[model samples]
Structure formats: structure tokens, C-alpha cells
Target: MAVLAIDIGGTKCAVALTDASGDILTSEVAPTPSGGDAETLWRALWSLIETTVGAEPVDGVGVGCGGPMTWPDGVVAPLNMPGWRDGFPVVARLRERFPGVPVRIHNDAIALAAAEHWKGAGQGVDDMIGMVVSTGVGGGLILGGRLINGGTGNAGHIGHIVVDPAGPPCGCGGNGCLEAVARGPALAAWAVEQGWVPGTPAAGPVNPELSEREAAALYRENARATGRQLATDAAAGDQIAVAAMNRAGWALGLAIASATHLCDVDLVTIGGGLSQSGPLLFEPLEETLRTHARMGFSSRVRVVPAALGQEAGLIGAAALIVGGDRYWSP
Candidate 1:
């Protein structure tokens, strides 16, 4: 049987119709509505679902959404998508469109976490954290063989965890959060403020102020300091690029260390565009973990890059429809 999945984001929505094994049969993409994100997003999703399910029977529907969500209950308050404050009637809307089909919805990060456990980097691990450090930072946690869905369904809002009490302000109205310090656009903005980057992208409610590709490229080009280098095949020997990566890694490690102490979760699967820096970030993270995490259990946590790339969100969303709570464990 084929399952149709839709991943909803502030800017874009991806639709995929796949089989029981999670093999894609049909796919579509649409821009999210700016002024009326919920309505526009739902409309796009409906269109995509209709197109994919046409002539082809589907087993179920899964929805992967952004954070500040009320899962199973079907509501979300994704800060990035400002037009939506209360919640989106995803379940009701999906039911209206495809009556009897079972539909499950979860935060995108949670869905991606499920995918990681099922088929991606966290394949064998019973306990793990899947994180997306993109234009924004989001995370999902699996504990004791079940998806950890809290009261608000935002159990794993790792980005908002205050890493630095004195750091820059975050959209969530906090200071020095991991999201403020290391999210894609935030990092790029930091770079631009320091004269590392020349231009700033528009900061609309829909778009952030950084470029993943551009930031990665810069990491390779301006390997000027011990803590700032563009990761590149050419700059493999450059000390600056190495340093920048180490700084990023250190930040990641520090946060993970804190999480390890709190949750006792030792395995973290890092995904998203920023993690593509790979060793540049991971190496420092390893070092930081060794220096920081005081508890023996915290030190033993294994931090690995996510095996699945962009496909993680879409695939994990589909897995949410069937896996129930067996996705990840701690």
C-alpha cells in the first residue's frame, strides 16, 4: 500500500506518495503562503495530495510540521511562520479531504528522528536525538522505545535551550539560545556582522537572513582565523577553516553535553544543511564533549552526522504514520 506524506514548512511544502517500504511513487512541491501561512499551506497540501492520490490508492497520510506544535491534537505555533499563532487544523482538514484514511502528524524534527531510527543514521540505536540545524534549529527525541511527545508536542525544542545567557536575542524572545547562536541564518548573520560576509539576505517573515550554500562556501574561502574557515577541498590544510569548524563543533558539543546530562541520551544524529560541514563541526564537538560533560554517562554519548539528508523529514513523516511510538528509544 502507498502512503502519501506531506511536509509543511514556513516557506515550502513537499508532498510524497510512497509505498509500505517508504519508496516514493509520486512527489510535488509548492511554496507556502506568506500572509496566511496556515490556509495557504493547507491549500498547497490539499492540492499536492489530490494530485498524488489521483488514480492511486493510498494507505495513510503523515504530516511533518515545524515546532511549538500540539501533536496528535493537531496544532502548531511555529515561530518562523508568524502568520500562524494558535494552531493549524491539519487533522480535520486531512480528514475532510480523504475521509477514512488514517493520518498522523508530528513536528518535522520528530518525524525526521523517526526516519533516523528506522532507516537513517540512528538505524541501530534504541536511544537517539535527531536534530536539524538549518535556517532554524529543531530536534526530536526518542526515549524508551517511544516518540517523546510532550504536552505541547514540542518536547524537543533543543534550539530554544539557552546555551548562553548573554548571547543575542532569539525570535522565541530569549537570549543566547542554540538557535540564536548556531542556526543557519543566525550563523551567517554573525559572520556578516563580523565582516566575514559581504551581503545580508532579506529577513522577511517567510525568509531568514542567511544562505546555507553561501555560508558553506565562505567557510572554505575565508580561512583567515583559527576559528573561521570555509570548509573546502582546497582549504583542507588551512588553519582558519579548521578553527571555524572547531568553534562550531564546540558549540554543538556543549549543547549536546548539556542535553546528555539532562536526558542521559548518548546518541545524537545531527542533520540539516549546517552539519554538511561534517568533521569541521564534529571534531570540535568530540573534543568539547571530552572536556565538558562531567558525568560519565554524558561523556559516553555518541554524536554522529545524520545519514539521511533533506529526505529525512519527508521519509520520517511517512514513518510516523505506521511506527506509532516505536521510532526511537533511550
Candidate 2:
């Protein structure tokens, strides 16, 4: 029997079947429908789940969804997802759909963290922060070899950490949040405001000749095109793009430094579209972190790109069941 894993994000949703060891056996991905109602979104995800699972029996089901949700129960209202702003009873819906199996849901970022800790970059590390810096910035905390759920299951959400009190307003209605400053879309928007022209590729409409899977992949790439273009331009000596990347990196470092001090974490694994900017981002982050994280215990902290890449969320979702003792309690 395999565990069913679901990863839901603002840009895409994925479903996978994985064995007890967390190795994916089969998977499917779809671009999350835009301008849809809550039910519409759920229907799309449900379609994927049903198609992926087919007649396969599963021992458990795990989900990683964009957060600001009521954990354990999984009533989510992801900040980036307007359709779900009114909240969706994800866990209840899944339980009804899959009856009899253990169903679990958690913040998508936390799921990625669990994956990194279980088999990726943070594999042997006992304390770490796993973060995603794409459409949004979110994270999960692992301390003393186990995941921390905090009081509201929102622990380790570093996206809203204030990096600049006077910076741009965030979707969360706060000013200068790390998410507002460093997330891919936010960073690209900032660069545009600063006169940096993003040379995003003309992905246009999905080619009619392409397979369904290829079309979905293209749609996902188009969603993050501007940010990816920014990285490319920065690499080619575009000063404005470089400045934008540096700005994002600095904010990330500042927030990570504060997190390191509070959590006493020794490692941070950063994933998502922006982290792909390579040294253009990490170099500035390292500089800012070193400057601010001067406390003796925080000085040795290491921040590196996540090793599991795009599959981190799926793997982590699987961990909620396979590695339940450490990553899941409710």
C-alpha cells in the first residue's frame, strides 16, 4: 500500500502516490485554477487526487496546503489565494473523500521542512528552518530533532517577520514583511518599480501541440516567469536586476538572523523560485546574516538552498504519515 500525498499552493497543486519510504511512485501536477471560488479550487484538486489514486489502496493521506489555516482541522485561508480567503474545510473534505484512512494536513512550508529533515539537505541536522521563497515566503521550524507546532500551528512562519518597518505593504496588510520584500512576485514588482525591465520570456498560451502534462508545466513556469527572468538578467550583468536580487537577499538574511536567534537553529534550507537566483541572492543574504547574527550561538548558522527542489512539499506531506511520530501530533 502507498500513502497519498497532496501539495497545494497558490500557483499549482500536485498529488502523488509514495511508498512508506517516501519515494514517489506516481504523481500529477496541475496549474491551480485562477479566479475561481473555493469549491472550484477544491474540485480541481479532487480531480487530481482521484485520477492519481485510481483503484490503489492507501494506508494514509497527507496534505500540505498554503497556510494561515486552523491546523489539525485544516480550515485554510491562504493569503495568496483569494478564492479561499473565506476559508475551506480541506481536512473534512478529504476525510469524506477517502474514508477510513488517516488524513493529515499542515502548512505547505512545514511539509517542505519535514522533507528536508527526513531525506534532503537537513537530513542529519537536528535543528533547522525550511523555507519557501516563491509566490510567497513561508517556513517551518525543526528543533531538537522534531517539528514544532507552536500554539496555533503557525510556528516558524517567518514570512511576516518585519524586515523593514517602512518598506512596501504586504498582502498580509503589513509593511516591510519579509514576504513583501523577498518573495518572487514581490521582488520582481519592486524591481519594476525601480526601473528594472524584466525580460520575461513570451510563454504566451500553451502550445496546442503539447501534451496536457507539458501544458500544465508551461503554465506553472509562466506564473513565475518574471522572477526567473530577474535572476537570469542579474546573472548577465544587469545592474538593476542585481540590485533587486541583493535587496531580496538582504531581507531574507535579516529575517533569518532574527529567526536563528530566537530558535537557536543551526541551519536554514531555502527553496522556491527566488532561491534559484544562486549567489546573486545567497551572497547578500550571507553578508546580511553575518552582520546581524553576531550572537555567539547564532554565528555558526548556515543557510543553504533546499536539496529536494520542487518535490520537497510532496515528500514532506508523505512524512506527516510515514514519519508521524516526529512531524505530526494531531
Candidate 3:
């Protein structure tokens, strides 16, 4: 049976039609309207659901969204998306659209984790870490063949982990949380602070409003920061592009060290746009993780990129509808 899948993220809304095999047959993308109210966001999603269905029938709906949500209830309050206070009832709205069909929602990071563990770089490992390094950094943990969805469905708040204490303040009211220091905005902001921004060289004045990619490009032509060069080829300079990423590289190393020390995981699968930076990101991540990790064979942990690509969520969501009690938080 085919399932309808929806992935709501910081930049855009992505919906697709997929089969049990996790193959996407059709998909669509649209900018998230800025209404800052749950009702308005609901209306926008409702409209998308209508356009997505277009008279075509599907078995069920599976959704993925940013975390700090109340699960089994489908209520979500994402960080980047304002106006979705009190958690949008995505399940209720989806059910409203498809009567008699069940709907399930998950943290996007967890869903991506689910996707990787089931059919990607984690194919052979029973314990693994699944991460998405896109506009922001999000991650999920799978242990002993089960995905860990913490109380209130907020287990994988990886991005919010404390990376730098003196760098910047995060939205979570913490100073130097990983998201604030390592996300796209921080990266761009750091570029401006460092005077590496486009039209604003180290010797020249700074461009306060310049984009991260532009700054990265300018820095690349004039600088030899291999890390920045990798970023330019990776995300094409997205918000999750440069500064946010070096932070991510270092933070991920520390995170893996802690996570591995705690759970003894043997494999790590990284996805999302930031992972696209290739070795520039991983080389540093691996080095740092090995250096600081608690004593053990953590150095043996094999870190690889995810293989499911965009279909990871759809396939993972479908897995939940068919076996949610076994795979995801129910």
C-alpha cells in the first residue's frame, strides 16, 4: 500500500506519495507561510494536503517535523517555525483529511534516524546514530534495534547540546547551545564578525547582510580554509552551511564521544545537507571524537553517511504505520 508522507522543516514543507517499499512516486515542495499562528499554519498545511491528494487515494499519512513535541498526540512545537505554539495537531488534521485512515507523526531527526537504521549506512548495525545536518542540526539514536524517542517524543535534541559556553546564546535560553553556535545563522554571523564576508575582506569593511555562501565563496577565493572549501561544495551556502557546520563538526565529535561512551554504539550514519561537506567535516569530527572520547574502542566506531536520501522519512514513516509499536514511539 502507498502512504502519504509529509516532512515539515525550517525552510519548506515537503510532501510525497510513497509505497511500502519507501519509493517516492510523486512529491511537492512549498514555502511555509509566515502566519505565526497554529490556525494559519494548519490552514496552509490543509491546503497542501488538498493539493497533495488531488483526488488520488492513499492508505495513511505519516509525518515528520522538528522536535520538542508531544507524541502519540501529534502535537509539535518546532524551534525555527514560529506561530506553532501549543503544538499543531498534525494527526488530527491529517485524519480530518483522510477518514478511517490512521496518522502518525515523529520528530524529523528520529524519522531520519529510523530511515538510516533500517536501510542505509546502518544496514548491518543494530545500534547507530542517525543525524540530519541541514538548515539546522538534528539527530536520533537507535539502540539494540529500537529507536529512542524520549518522554514527550523529544529524545534527539542533539542540536541543542551545549557546544560552546561563551560563543552565543541559543533560542533555548542557553548560552552557546549547539544549535545557536553551529547553525547557519551563527556561521554567517561569525563570518561577518571575522571580516571574511563577501565585499568585506579581513582588511576591508564587513558586509553585515551578506549570505553565508557569499562569505564562504569570498573566503575561499582569498583563503585556504579547507573546511570552508568543503562547505562551498556541500550546501551551496545554505544557512546550515558554513559557521554552523564547523561548530557542528566539533559538536558532533563531542556528542559522539558522549553518546558512544554511554551506549557503546558501533556505527554512526550521518545525513542531511551538512554531511554533504564530505571529509572536510568528517575528518575533523573523527579526529576530535577520537581525541576526547572516554576510553574504550570508540575509535572503532564506523561513521558513514546515510544512504536513504530524501525517501528516508517516507520509508521510516511507513515503517511506523505498519510497525510503529516496534520501531517508533507509540
Candidate 4:
């Protein structure tokens, strides 16, 4: 069966057409209309969907969107997407557009977990956690060979797990949350505050002669100091950048240790822009995890980078329909 998959995030929105095995047949991506109102953003996304799907009939539609949403209902108010902070009825609109086909929506992080378990890093593992440490930190859990949707459908939300009692304030109106310290922008900001200068940007506007892809790359490079730049600097041996990575890694390990103890999960698959930092991040994370996760069961847990890379979100979204009740319920 053909399924329509949508992945919505602050930086970009992607749509894909996939078969039963979650292999994408066709896909499209565009920068998110983050500065626009909800209606404008939705219209843009719908246009992308229409263009990608064309006249092909999909059997079901599934969406993975950033969270703090009312799930099953799919009323989203993703913290990073300011335009949708008031909440958008994504599932209702998808149902309206697709009619008889089943429509499913879940936290993007949860979708990532489902994707990993279905076809990626956690494929053979019955209990694991999938985490994204990019624009923000988020996670989803699988246990006993099935996805776990807690009371509010927000169960494996590890981003808000506190790693330090006296750390920075978080966007969730709490202090010392893991997201507050480890999210890309937050980590970069922390690095800047500690006197680390990010990569220098070209002085002029993106050259009109450049290809669309090149121009987009230039624009992003010029926009702000982000976790990507921090990683670059760390690789170049910048002390403050190294320190920032260590801090983020340490925080991630602490939170993971807590999650291991709580859920008894044995594997963690991490993805997203920041995870690209390679060993600079994972080494400290491993060291810290070993320090705190000393219990017999938790000690065996392993953390690894996600195997599906950028397509994981879309694949996971498709799994909501393709995998049937194994990854989706209500």
C-alpha cells in the first residue's frame, strides 16, 4: 500500500510517498514558513504535499510533527515553531484533505523511535529509545517489541528530564531541563557566552550566480551561530567549543542514565544535526553514562547514532500507517 508521510519541524517540512516497506518513492522538502501564521504555514505545507503526491492515491496518511501537542488529536504547539505555538489542528486538516483514508499523527520524536525500531538502528531490539538532539532535544521509546504511548501520548519525552538542579532555565517553564542545556541553539548560545566566536560569515548576500543548493547553504551559514558551527570549531580544536560539546554530552548521558533506570531500555539511537559531532560528543557521553548507570541492568545499555540519518523522520511517519498497530494506536 502507498502511504503519505509528512515530517514537520521548525527549519523544514518534508513530505514523502512511500510503499509498505517505508522506502520513499518520491519526496519534497522546503524551508518551513516559520515566520508566517498558522494558516500560511499550513497552506505552504499542503502545496508541497499536493506537488509530491500528484494524482497518486495513498491508502493512509501519517505525520510526524514537533511536539508539546495533544496527540491522537494532533493539536500541535511545537516549541520551536513559533508560528504554530498557539496550536494547529494538523490531524483534522489531514483527515479533511484525505477523506476516507486513515490519518495518524504523533510527536516527531516518537515517530523517530518507531522508524528506528521498524527499519533502522533498533530494528532487532525490542526495547530502545530514539533521541534527536538538534534544534531541541526529544525522544521516544519502544518496549516489549511495541511503541509505548503513555497517558498523554507523550511518553518517551526525555528532553524535559532534568540533568542538573542548578542549570539554565528551560523553554518549558522549568529550570535545568536536559533540552535547556543540550539543544543546538542553546548549546551554541552557551558557547558564545563563554567567549567562543563561531565561524565567520561572508559579508555579502548569497551570490546570485550560485546554484539554489549552494545559495541555501550560504544563507544558513550566514544566519546564526548554531550547533553545527560549534561542532566545526570543536573539530578545529577550539577550547570553548570543546567545552560546550562536553557539557551537552554530559547532560545527555545523565538524562539517558535516568531513562535507563526508569524504563529499563537497553539501547538508545540518537539522530539529528548535533549528533554529527562524532566522538567529540559520544566519548564524554559514554564516560558519563558509565559513571552514573552502574546498576546491573542499566549498565548494559548501549548508545549509538541513528542509522537512517535525515530520512528517519519521514520513514517513521510512514511506519505509523505501514506498520499498522505495531507503531500506531488511536
Candidate 5:
């Protein structure tokens, strides 16, 4: 079967058409519309869908939406998306658009897990955790060869798992959540507070001419850049940036250790924008994981970067329809 896959993220929306083998036939992405309001976002997605599916036949639609959503119905109130906090009827709208087809929706991270389990890093692994540590940290779990969905289909929401009781407040209105302490924005904000400037020179003033207000604006801009350059600087031996990355990895390691203790998943496949930082982030993460994962089983779990890269979400979305319940949907 050919499936239409939709990946709705905080900053962008992507659409892809995939064949039964989970190969993307066509795909396209667009920035989430300004304001990110329901109508605007929906229109943007629809346009992308149309563009991706042009002259092609599709049997079903699968959507990967950011969470804090109501499942079975697919009502979303994604925390990072202010315009959607009131909830958007995602599955309902998709069903309305494609009647009589099997339209399925899952959290974006969960969808990525499905993709990884099917054709990416988690292939042949009976139990694993798939994590995306980008603008936020999100995760999905596969245990006993089945996707583990809690009653509300939010089972593998590792991001909100509290790693530190005294850590920063998360957008989910909780303290010390992994997303709040280890994600890109959180790391960048912490680095700025620690005197790291965006365009800091190796051996010169961070910024000589910029006033306090200008510096703050620059921080905002740098924070908006998603901590990628910070990773680069850290790799280049910038102390402040290295500190920030270390903090992020340490926090994540704590969470992963706890998760390993509870579920004992043997593999963690890390994806998303920040995971691209490679060893600069992974070194600290592995070091911390080694320290915290004291139990024999827990210590055995290995963390690795995702193999599918950015297309994991799109492929996972398509897998929702193509792979069916055993391999994809919860």
C-alpha cells in the first residue's frame, strides 16, 4: 500500500508518500506558518500534502504530531506550539480530508521509534528506546516486540520524566523535566547565563560593542539557532559551549539511566537535530550513563545515533500505515 505520511513538528511540517517497503516516493517540508494557528498550520500541511501526493494514489494517511495530545481521536495541544495549546483536531481533519481510508496518528517521537524499529537502528531489536533530543527531548519505546502505549497512547514520553527535582521548569508545567534541562533551547539559555556569547571569539571579548539589550537579543537569536553552533564551538574547545553540552548530556544520561532501570531496554537510538553533535554530546552522555547505570542489566544498554537521520519521522509516519499494528501503531 502507498501511504501519505505527515510529520507535524513545532517549527515545520513535512509530508511524504511512501510505498509498502517504507521507501519514500516523494517528500516535501515547509516552515510551520507564522502564528502557527490551527487554520494556518492546517493549510500549510494540506498544501504540502497536495504537492507530495500529486498524481499518485494513496491508501491511507499516517500523521506524526507533537504531543500533549488526546489519542484514539488525535487532539493535540503540543506544548511548544502556543497556537495549538487549546487543542487541534488533527485526526478528525485528516479523516475529513480522506474518507474511508485508515487514518492513524501517533506522537512524532513514537512514530520515529516505529520507523527505527522497522528499518533503521532498532531493526531486529525486540526492545529499545528511540529518542529525539532537539528543540525538546522526546522518546518512544518498544518492549516485548510491541509498541508500548499507555492508556492515552503517551507511554514513551521520556522527556517529561523528571531527572532532577530541582531542575528548571518545563513547558509542560513541571520541574526538572528532561526537555527543560537537556534540550537545545535550555542548554543555550543556560550557556548565555554563564557568560557565553553567540559570536564569541576564541581569545577576545565575547562582544565588545553590543549593549546589554543587544546582547540579550543576540542570545535569543543564538538560542533560536538550536544549539548546533554551540556544539561546534564545544568541539572546537570553547569552554562555555563545552560546559553547556556537558550539562545537557549529563541530564539526559540521568534520565536514560532511570529509564534503563525501569524498563531495561538494551539500545537507545538517538535522533533529531541535536544528536548530530556526535561525540561532543555523546561522550558526556556515555560517561554519565556509565556512572548512573550501576546495575548489570542497566549498564549493558548502549546509546547510538540514529541511522535514518531526518527522514525517520516521515518514514515512521508512513510505517504507521504500511507496517500495521505489529510493527508500527500502538
Candidate 6:
């Protein structure tokens, strides 16, 4: 029997039909509704779900979502997707849509951790952390071969960990959180503050043409453009871009090292759009890890890129139903 897998994010919603072995039979994606309300977002997700599995029937459904959520109950108030701040009754809706099929919900990062443990970087590892660093930073942990979902299902939320007490403010209302320093927007804003101008495709080898006013407008309007474009610049040897990425990597490495000090996880698998920046990010990350990890065991922990890539969350959702035996341990 196939499992219907759903992944909801701030920018998009994805649905997939997968069998027990993690093969995706069908999949679909849609931009998140621009209205940013619960009903509008649900409409987009419902459309993707129907398009992906309308004719095909599935035995069960599993959902992965970014969260301030209640698992099993499947209610969510994802910080990135404020439309559901009042809390979304996701499991109830899925149950109503697919009557009699088992339905379960997981924090997206936790789901990714489970998927990684089953088939990706954490395979065969008894203790691990899975992290996604893109528009935001998020994480999940597996220790003693059991997925740790804390009292409110928010365990392993490493993003909000305070790293710099005097650093910038975070959306979570904290100061100097890992998310505040290392997320894409933070990196871009830092680069911009240091006078990095975004190069345009049309500008060729010439410096960016935009006046300061025009550049600031672009920066304000397109928050992610800075980080994405800066990655390109860093690859081509732009000093400021490299510095921005280096700072981000250092902050992330510090956070991971701190977490390792506490959990002593054997591995940390990073998956996210930012991870694609490759050595421009990872080099500094490794340096920081080596510099900050004081304990012998913490220094031994391996940090690697996630193998399943973009499909980790979808596969993880499906895994909740198809491979629970492989992941769950008392």
C-alpha cells in the first residue's frame, strides 16, 4: 500500500504518493497561497493533494510541517506560515479527506531526521541530528535510536538557541539566536550592511548598476535574493559575499558544537537550500566546529550533507506510515 505524503512550507506545499520502500510514485507542488490565511493555504494544499493522488488510492497519510505544533493531534502554528497561527487542524482535515486511512503528523525537521536515520546520512547511526538551514534554521534529534519529540513536539529546535547574547533580534523574540545570525535573510542583511551590491545578470563583469536607493528597494522587496545571489558571488571570489557566508557558517558551526556538547550525537546531517552553497559554507563550518568543540566526543561527531536532498521531508512523511518499524524504538 502506498502512503500519501505531504510537506508544507512557507513558500510552497508538496504532496507525494510513495510506496513502503520510499519510491515516489507521483508528486505535485504549488506555491503557497499569497493570501497567507489558513483557508487559502489549505486550498493550495488540497489542490496539490488531489492533483498528486486523485486517481490513485493510498493506504495511509502522513504530514510534515514546520511547527509550533501538537503531534498526533496534528494541529500546527508554523512560525514561517503565519496563516495558521491560530492553529490548523491538519489531521482532522486529512482524516475527513481520506476516511479510515491512518493519518499522522510530524514536525518537518523531525520527519527529516527520521528519514535521514532510515536512508540518508544517519543510516546505521544510533544518535543523530538533522538540520535544515534556508529561510530559517530548524532541527530534529534522534538519540538512543529513538526520535525525541518533546512535550509539545518541539524538541531539537536548535534554531532558537541563543548563541550571541548581544547579537541581532530573532523572530522568536530572542537575541542572538542561531536563526537570527545564520538564516539566509540574516546573512544577506549583514552583507548588505557591509556595502555588498547585488550583481545583476545584465551587468556582466561590470559592477552592479543600481543606485543605493534602487538596491535597498530590491533588498527590501526580495528578502531571499541577497543570500541566493551572494552565493553566486562567493563562488566567483567576491570578498564580501565570502565573508557573509563565512559568518553564517561560523554561527551555525558554533550552534551545532554547543548542541553536540549536550546530546553527543554521532552525526549532523544538513539539508536545505543553503546547504547547496557547498564549500563556500562548509569550509568555515568545519573550521568553527574544530575550533569550538572542546570535548573529545564532540570533536568526533561527523557533519555531512543530507543525501535525500529536497525529497527528505516528503519521504520522511511517508516513512511515518511505511517504515515506522525502522525508525521507532522504545
TM-score of each: 0.82, 0.89, 0.80, 0.91, 0.90, 0.89
**lDDT (0 to 1) per candidate:** 0.72, 0.88, 0.71, 0.90, 0.84, 0.84
Cα shift from native, residue 11, model 5 (Å): 2.0
lDDT of 6 by residue, 156-255 (tens): 8899888889999999887899999988888889988997766632223432786765765655454344567778777767688889999988898999
Per lDDT, the best of the predicted structures is 4
Once fitted onto the true fold, the runs of candidate 2 whose alpha carbons sit more than 4 angstroms away are: 200-225
- TM-score for candidate 1, residues paired by index: 0.82
lDDT of 3 by residue, 157-231 (tens): 777777666858777788777667555555556655554333323322235576766764665566433334336
The residue ranges of model 1 lying beyond 4 angstroms of the native Cα positions read 33-38, 82-86, 198-244, 327-330
For 1-330, candidate 4 gives per-residue lDDT tens digits of 889999998889999999999999999999998589999999999999999999999999989999889979899998878888999999999999999999998999999999989998898998999999988898899998889999989888799999999999998899899999999999999999998767532222346788766765665666467888888778767788899999999999999999999999989999988899999999999999999999999999999999987888999999999897889866
Comparison by lDDT, 3 against 4, better one: 4
Which ranking of candidates, highest TM-score first? 4, 5, 6, 2, 1, 3
- Tens-place lDDT digits, model 2, residues 1-330: 699999998889999999999999999999999988999999999999999999999899989998789988999998778899999999999899879989998999999999999999998999999998887898999999999998888888899999999998988888999998888878788888887755422222347787766765665555443778778778867688889899998999999999999999999999988888789999999999999999899999999999997788899999998996799975
In candidate 5, position 90 carries an lDDT of 84
Backbone collision tally, model 3 = 4
Report the Cα lDDT for residue 57, model 6: 83
Ranking by lDDT: 4, 2, 5, 6, 1, 3
Which 10-residue window of candidate 4 scores lowest in summed lDDT? 197-206
Indicate the worst ten consecutive residues by lDDT in candidate 6: 198-207
Clashes of each: 13, 0, 4, 0, 0, 0
Candidate 1 lDDT at 272 equals 78
- Output the better candidate (1/4) by lDDT: 4
